[model samples]
Target: MENRSHALMTGFFTITLLIAAVLFGLWFNRDRVERVPYMLATTQPVPGLNPQAAVRYRGLDVGRVSDIDFDPKVTGQILVSLNIDPDTPITRSTFATLGYQGVTGIAFIQLDDEATGSPRLATNSTNPSRIPLRPGLFDQLEKRGKRILAQSEEAATRLNELLSPANQKVILGAFADVSATANAYRALPQQLEPVIARLPALADQAQGTLQSVSALAADATRLTRKLQAPNGPIERISGTVERVGLSLEAVGNGVELEALPHVISLTEDTRASMRALKNTMNNLNERPQSILFGAPGTPPGPGEAGFSAPTK
Candidate 1:
């Protein structure tokens, strides 16, 4: 009987000690800060999120998720309840999103305020201020997965078309043409060898022609200067023209003054001689024997000193 009693006492003491230890642990880990309740409603899926998930205010541990359930009032809507510290500065512009802890897939509530000057959100058990739950990175990627897959398929189809047999043949043909062009370029220097060899002679000929042209131009310049000189060809020709003009004037004066009167008097003497010669010719024609006798008697008229009226 004493042994049984001692065993019971030992068990009771052990149980009491365990209970005290648990109580002390609970007291040490208890949260002393006053918290405000908030609700998050979303229609988007919250993967890896559950009750007791940590709630962070801009990366700071501010609270924990208390509950997650479908909204009883709205169909297809989820409601998440959070108990955030009263000093967390939750406001009307504060919002929440689901975030993951690295690659673990563990989700938490990330709280952030869009406007710092927004009015404080007031809440209680009866009605908590609702925060909008926006789609997380994973959720957005999942939603766009189908569209991304469609675009990838389109890109693959285009790549296949580009690598088709016909396109491959065309590409090979273009490479062959490029090789031919390279061969042509390699042979071009040999083809131009003859022309290159003649370049020195051509250069010498061009230099000679240029020198000749330069000499001709210099001669033309000298001739132009001489023509423009005061005592040059132009001046000599002008002086010659003035002297010729004076000589012509002198000849004209002499012709009009001395030569003109002499010519007129000579013309008058010639006229008288012509008249006497004409009379002598008429007398000889009337008496043809007078030419041989060298004489002709004058016949008198009625008014003469030896006036004779001859009978018929």
Candidate 2:
């Protein structure tokens, strides 16, 4: 009886000690932080995602997924529940996506805010605030895979058409033409050698022509300057012309003031002489012997002069 009681007491002490140790461990592992509840809803598939998956806010661990279920109210919609730290700053603009660990296919919730200044999301145990679950990288790729495949097929078809036998022949012909052009380019310098050799002579001739033109221009400029000089040949010629004009004026003045009077007197004297000569000519015509004999004596006149009546 004593041995049995001792064994029972020892077993009880050991069990109590194990129980205290377990309680201490539970106390140590208890979460003291208050966590806020959030809900995420989506119609997209969440591959490799399960309950208790880590929830991250911009790559930081902020929470854990609590439950994943289908919405009974909305058909074909999934609902994911999360318990996040209260300080995680979940807001109305916050969204969720599934991220994967490297090559492990383990999916976690990735939370991101579209706008940092969004109003805080309100939640309670009965009605948690909802975050939208958007498509992940793999989901987007999977969704676009058919279109990408179609485009790739189109590109491959175009490539095959472009590389057909006819196009290949055309490409070879173009390459041959390019080679011919390159050969022509290589021979261009030799073809231009004669013209290049003659360039120096041509340049010398052009220089000589330019020098001759310059000399001509200089001579013309000098002649123009001489012509424009104040006391040059132009001035001398102008002075001579002025003197000639003055002499002509002086001759005109002499004719008007001195020679004009003499000319008038000479004209009157000549006129009187002409009148007497005309009278003498008339008398000689009447008497032919008047030139040799003196004037006939005056005959008795009726009055006082020699006037006589002829008897018939």
TM-scores, all candidates, are 0.59, 0.59
Tens digit of lDDT per residue, candidate 2, span 1-312? 999999999999999999999999999998677788999889988889999899999999998898999999999999999999989888888888899999999999999999878899889989998999888888888879978999999999999999999999999999999999999999999999999999999999999999999999999999989988999999999999999999999999888998888899999999999999999999989998977997798678777665777899
- lDDT, candidate 2, equals 0.92
Clash-forming residue pairs, model 2: 301-307
User: For each predicted model, how many residue pairs clash, with residues at least 3 apart or on different chains?
Assistant: 0, 1
lDDT of 1 by residue, 150-236 (tens): 999999999999999999999999999999999999999999999999999999999999999999999999999999898999999
After superposing candidate 2, which stretches have Cα over 4 Å from the reference?
1-34, 115-117, 137-153, 231-312
What C-alpha RMSD separates each model from the true structure? 18.2, 17.0
- Give Cα distance to truth, residue 96, candidate 2, Å: 2.1
